[model samples]
Target chain A: MKVAILGMGSVGKGVASVLSSKDLGVMVTGVADSRSGLIDPDGINIGALLATKRSTGLCGSAGITAMDVVRGAPYDILIEVTPTDAVSGEPALTHIRTALTMGRHVVTSNKGPIVHALHALRSLAASKGTSIRYEATVAGAIPIMHTLADGLAGNEVLALYGVLNGTCNYILTRMAAEGLTYEQALLEAREMGYAEADPTYDVKGIDAAIKLVILANTIWGTSSCLKDVEVRGIDLVTLDALQLAEDQGCTIRLIAEADPSNRILRVSPRILRSRHPLVTEGTLNAITLVTDLAGEITLMGKGAGSVETASAIIGDLLAIRSRYGRCD
Target chain B: MKLEMRDAPGQLVAALKPISDLGGNIIAVIHQRDPGSRSEVLGVQIVLDLPQDRLSDLTDLIRSQGVNILRVNEERLLCTRAVIMIGHLIHTDLGGTVDAIDRTGFAEVTGLTIRMPAIDQRSSARFTIRSVNREHMEDAIAILRTVAREKGLLMIEPMGVSQ
Candidate 1:
């Protein structure tokens, strides 16, 4: 199977490496970035890219722009791993839209396009008779998207909520368990590479808001844009605040949530003491999909990283390959 | 100086009574139900435009009422600009991203729009940004770029920095 990676960053490189594994039956044909990329439709040497990346924290190899990758010889799947911006996920949007238009299936870890352009993209995919699978968008490798889209297809998801952002969840979990101040915990998270240097989105709850938009829209056939939802961040979550909430039998978890009935989605630091299955927290993403028949389906696991997320993209690609590869 | 009083039962009224009794005009009261959880605390981003001469008095009065002052600083929200970002937007924490932009004290994500197909893909968003100074908008964009990199997002600045 031919595969192309749209971004050469951590996740993009990770996907390339995973798909290169002989067992996966995938051959990475090209790797692109905002800058140009390297392509070998015959199959690029992903092992070489990984060895270089590990030794030197930079990509010095030939690169291709997203346009080049999409325009090149078709691939069985394209992994759009471009970086995400809070406002416009342009290049990735351009990459996915183009790939869909070109009749190529796309599997991405980019949340920007999924959170902001799901319907249009899906409609485009339908028009092109192509599929866009993004199992790694929410809950990382936990398969939440598949569970809702396939496993629980019979159930009508009433609401879905969880600790969607590992950075915030790590910070909040540290603050809750180790009794660190929000600042102290956030500092630790940054030092450990769990939180970004800027750390604003993780601390404030906007990252979770984006995830909630995706979750809500996926469960319910609605747009659920970020503007429609209410967002409160954890930046205001003082030690005193967390302590007070804990005193009230609650643990503060940075939660991204959507209520299907109200058609509303929200993200913020939530004090959960409901003794529910999803209340436990840490560097884990746990989601509770409330449904009419299944009642509630909860999934929890590592929600980020190259290996975990890449594994998900690979899994989706393989599944798609098994069902649709021979046809195209 | 100003304080953030918990929006508990009679908390605002209680805090206000003290401010009024102490001769404070309660210059501006900004209150809104927290959109995330209704059962949770309501968020109030109030700005008390007190007379400079009476600022200290108002601060002390509000403090005495046990209303915690969340933030006390200069008042400014002029000259806003809009920006758009693309990629893993929500998962990257759009609220935190906006808050980070706002932390510069010059800009904030006043409005946001997002669309997600599923959990594990690039998400797109449009952010209406507002800043105090015109130049601060650039600083806000820089901060957004840094955030976008960490969140595995591809930021689409309105200025259109080509990839």
Candidate 2:
């Protein structure tokens, strides 16, 4: 399968590196970073593009643009792994829309478009006889979308609870394990590169809420807006709170939950037992989905990282390839 | 519950009928007829499982059946949820917060443990709220949420069904 990947950040590089190493009958015909774009009718040299990206910080010719690659590249799938703009399903949304309108399959790790234009995008993909798969938009490496859509195909999901934010989880883990104050732990997270400079999106619970919106929309087919989520950040959580939770063999975690039956969509700091399945440590993410046939199943893994996110995106690609079958 | 009904043959049937009418399950009924012990009344001990809300209705129906109820032990407020509130607890009128649930009749804040780092700093408290059933518990938490919002407090409810 020929694929075009946008966003040559860590995720893009990881995908390129993996495809270069694995002879999985996949070819990268096009790639684009923020500043440059590359296209080749045959397969692009993954090693050369990565080396140029590493040395010069530009993935390809600056004369080319992202839409140029999206519209002009000859590929079976468009991998839209751009940066997320939760407020506006950004340039990625337009890119995905254009690709689907062109009757091309899409695989993306972008949450902005997924959160804003999922219903519309899915309908457009269906109308064009193509589909968009976004496994990396939620928990980074959990393969949650495939698990819900394929592995547990017939089971009805009753409810979902997740620790979807890695930065907050890291802060909380450090706070509880080392008795660091919220501020101190947040600083530690920033130093360790787990948290961004602003950290508002992660610590303020907006990031997790966005991922929850994506998961909820996919599983229940409910076009839930981000505003529908009742979000609470961990910014105000104090040492005393964690201490009190630990007093009773429990800890605090920023939890995102969706219960369609209860009409609940929430992301907040919740008291969880220390041994609970959702009480994941460090930058790990965990999701517990309650289903009728399978009961409750918890999936946990790296929520964010180069290879971790690439794993989710590649899974989506392979799923589309398998469903449609190999052409070569 | 233990009951004293007249030793009439059909009196026992009258009392037992109301138990099932209220959608109660009769787990066991120790109605032993001591051949020589009963002077004029039959002392029968009955155990049953029923919704706590219908305890009053069951008591009323059994009394109208001419059975004197000596003792009734129905556990009310059997369901409890623990929530943590972190904010200016005292400044926000913590008494009002607890009173909000306690006044609901069905739900009450039964336990509390506070950790005040300093007088000027914010305080954190874990409150155990008890209610009769799941619906009542939900209502109680909703009230706390409203109160927490008004007080500018962060209310952290327990997650998972195990709590």
Candidate 3:
């Protein structure tokens, strides 16, 4: 399958590296970063592309933009790994819409488009005989979406509980394991590159809430958005609260939960037992899917990383290829 | 076929005689004897390989023997492949990986064998997967490849053969 990747950031570079390193029967025909774009119908040289990005902080030559890649690039799959803007769901949403409407399958890691316009995008994909897969949006590399759509097929998903935010989980884990205060844990998380500089989304629980919205919509077909989720961050989870929970043989974790049967979706710092499956350490994500047939199935994996998120995008790419081989 | 039979002497043997008498080969028999149950009935799930013409005869013979057949389901797994995966299989949660494939109704990991030399070293497993058909088998393998890539494992798939 021929793929065009937008947003040549960490995850985009990871996808390009995987495509170049592995013989997964996929070729990168076009690539676009924020500033420039490159197009080669035969197939772009990914090694050279990476070198160019490393030396000059850009993907391609002058006068080439993302619009050119989206409108004129020759490819079958459009991989949108751009950073998300939960408020607007812009540029990424437009890119995905263009691809799906043009009869090209879309695999994205951006949560904005999915959280904002899921039904509209899905309708367009269906009408155009294409698909939009975003396994990397929720829990990176967990295959939660695939499990819901295919593995747990023919079963009703009763509820879903997950440690959807890696930054909060890491901070909370440090506080629980090493007895650090919330501020101290947050600083350590930032130092370790687990938490972003602003850290507002990660610490304020908006990230987890957005992920919950995506999961709720994907699994239960609910028209949920960021506003629908009852959000509570770990910013106010004091050390005393952590100690109190520890005294009761539990640790505080930022849990994102969706109960479709009762129409409940929330993300908050909840006290779970120290040895709970969802109580994972470091930058790891865990999700427990409560289904009728499979019972309670928990999947744990690296929540965020270049290659890890790339693994999910590649999985979606392979799924598209397997379902509809090389549309071109 | 799942049947409920009286928990009495010779009840087990009596259930098999009809299948054998109608030229059916018994592949497996899962007999569950619940001692705490109030009813004096045992559940028996028998996997049989037989011609379609003999199914009616077998069911009729079993019914005549007073065995209550609860359910009958066709075995859909007709294609199988054995693959060997190597790396930190245990640390990466091999059970979760296997469950991802097995939970798919069209494919299942029917058998598994693992080998580990040390606690910190790499491990390997030979997995026998059965699917509804060749297409399903391919899909199962594709899922395995995705899991293997995510977990940093090496998967050696079978070539041009089905077990």
- DockQ winner among the candidates? 2
Could you estimate the TM-score for every candidate?
0.64, 0.87, 0.67
Give the 10-residue window scoring lowest on summed lDDT in candidate 2 chain B: B154-163
Stretches of candidate 1 off by over 4 Å are A53-63, B1-163
Error of 3 at A2 (Å): 0.6
Question: What tens digits encode model 2's per-residue C-alpha lDDT throughout B46-163?
Answer: 8887887789899899999999999987766667778999999999898999999998898999899999989999999999988977777888888999999999999998885322
True contacts kept of 1: 0.00
What clash count does candidate 1 reach? 66
TM-score of 1: 0.64
Q: How displaced is residue B8 in candidate 2, in Å?
A: 23
RMSD of each: 17.9, 4.9, 18.1
User: Per-residue lDDT of B58-119 in model 1, one digit per residue for the tens?
Assistant: 66776777777776786555555444454666666667887897677667788776655468
* Candidate 2: residue B71 lDDT (0-100): 94
User: What is the per-residue lDDT of model 3 for residues A1-328, given as tens digits with 9 covering 90 to 100?
Assistant: 7999999999999999999999998888889988889999999999999999999999996689887898898889999999998999989999999988899999999999999999999999999999999999988989988988888899998888899999999998888788897799999998998988899999999999999999988887779888889777877665555655565466678888888765668786665667788889888899998888889899999999999999999999999988986666
lDDT of 2 at A87: 86
* TM-scores computed on chain B for all candidates: 0.48, 0.63, 0.55
- Each candidate's fnat, listed in order, reads 0.00, 0.79, 0.00
Question: Which of the two candidates, 2 or 3, achieves a greater lDDT against the reference?
Answer: 2
Better of 1 and 3 by TM-score: 3
lDDT per residue (tens digit) for residues B1-163 in model 3: 9999998998888889988888877889998876778888889999987666678788888888889989988766868776666678899998898998989988899988776757986665767799877878978987997998799775655433321
